[model samples]
Target: MDPTEVNVPDVKDMNIDNITQNTILINSQCESERVKYLFERLVTHLHDFARETRLSTQEWKAALDFLVTVGQISSDDRHEFILLSDILGLSLLVDAIDHPKPPSSTEGSVLGPFHSHKAEVVPSGSDISSDPKGRPCLVLCTIKDPSGAPIEGVKIDIWETDSSGHYDVQYAEHDRPDGRCVMTSDEEGRFWFNAIVPVSYPIPHDGPVGKLLKLLKRHPWRPAHMHFMFEKEGWDHLITALYIHPDPYLTSDAVFGVKDSLIESLGSVSAEQAKAYGVREGTALISRDFVLVSDDETQRLRDSNALAAMADLFPGKKIKLLDHLPVPDLD
Candidate 1:
């Protein structure tokens, strides 16, 4: 039986809206087992939700229009719709399911909309401060195995919102990479770069997504944080964020990227330590260490399976998922 036609009223004289009939028609076309099951569940839940809320015709139409615009605004470099998904918590839910990292490894967060291409590769001790406006800081980091032994020669790509809490992409012609750097760890798996402390900033609010946030009365701010992408041989790559100590939005990050283990105290340095690190007394230095897991054949197989399952659910063309998300390919 045609699923769409099945919903037609028994009497020939009965009348129903075209929209409702079209929804049923689309569901009928989704005959694959997975798609069929998903459609049935979604339709049931949506119907129940509308009944429970006594949804008005205007409210439903506005929601559909908003989604249509969201898709329309998404593109190769910009993903305003993904940001909308993030702020609405769907992104976090997907991350949680995909990356249940081992207890020893820190939890991950959203790869926000502003991550860009072509961070200039540089050596350790060179300043990560491509622009001089953020708070002056020296970040000292160590990459180690779970057993506390260093993993040699890991590449760390780091970026963060500037001192003013705005990324370079926020401004059209910043002419410099603010709070972003590409550095490699040494033979001992230790790396350090000079930069300024990052401030918490709001997500972009000048677009359709922003208008929706204002309509919903939600704040657009994310906590002050540093974004890190690390990779080394014989180990799984890491893409994670570190939250600033005492940032007001730490607990309520708009993207829900804050993880307890990822928080580090931006330590106050003594005069002597300041001199050694080339910073002034009373300057804040962020000292943190990351532990990456070594992957055996078993772990590699598990990761592959998880990636396959993710592709099945999200497909290649929908939501970008992990396909476009960069990871180091160590062959």
Candidate 2:
């Protein structure tokens, strides 16, 4: 495309009254209709916000500088931008819009920035953590379709924090996997594992997003939960977490990722029961059955009048689920 052939309005003598229109006019040359529409709307909203707030030039510069700092602090293992989005509830909102599920299906939640591709596959009933760090827990889960039929061979990735409310990756000298593992469901669609009772923890609060939270007088605590990502051929991938019932932060999750349907109680396990589950005595138990929607069904729901009305901005372009992490070799 020749630069001289590009159609755009002249930028001379631009003022607040015409700046937004000129910006949209120039952006109209975008080749992709979806991108063009998105940016046009984005510009309009941004300009309207500035005008309505009477934003000063100094405040705008400060906001840009804050974003720059966010980028500067991000790394391969740490995603500050994702934290920013999570703190602002944008991540959960986007997830809700993209993944509309049937009432029977498990609800999706925000995938925090700490998921690692380094989790190793372990056999069912094996302990995810090498050494016990908190009250032992036996997690028994079943994967089933919406119709209640067992779905076998669903890959499940699980992770959680230790008693002190810290993940292995949060350690400065983090070098080995702990409190996380991957496994597959059995013929009965059942998978059981030994884990710690997850505790309520603070999201990483030493960054710019934390500063923003402070400015808003919001706490940075999340409810106790265990992360799970399930994947199976022909099924819509599900990224969700099970919240511990009676958690103080259940109604005030920092990331707004909790759903009433996803909450489960931790019950006391007797010595015989713990032995039966292949865990030590005094261990607690949490049992849950997850219902997955098939890919075809998910697409149909996305196109339905209910969901389409809320997320029809990108017609014909389905929102892709997060890519599945590589299946680790079974130990």
Clash pairs for candidate 1? 135-196
Candidate models: Cα lDDT each: 0.73, 0.86
**What TM-score would candidate 2 get against the native?**
0.89
List candidate 2 segments past 4 Å from native.
Answer: 270-272, 305-331
Provide the lowest-lDDT 10-residue window in model 1: 319-328
The weakest ten consecutive residues by lDDT in model 2 span 321-330
lDDT (Cα, tens digit) per residue for candidate 2, span 57-150:
9999999999999998888778999999998899998778667788879999999999988999988988897655588888989999988999
Which candidate's TM-score is highest? 2
lDDT of 1 by residue, 1-331 (tens): 7766765333333233343344545575554544554565577668768868888999999989988887787664468988998888888777665555676765667778777665778888777765566667778889887788888888788887767777776766666665677887877888888878888888888777889889889889988888898876777667788888898898888778888888887887789878887778887788888888765632654466556765675465232223423222223
Candidate 1: list runs displaced more than 4 Å.
Answer: 1-57, 72-77, 295-331
lDDT of 1: 0.73
Q: How many clashing pairs does model 2 include?
A: 0
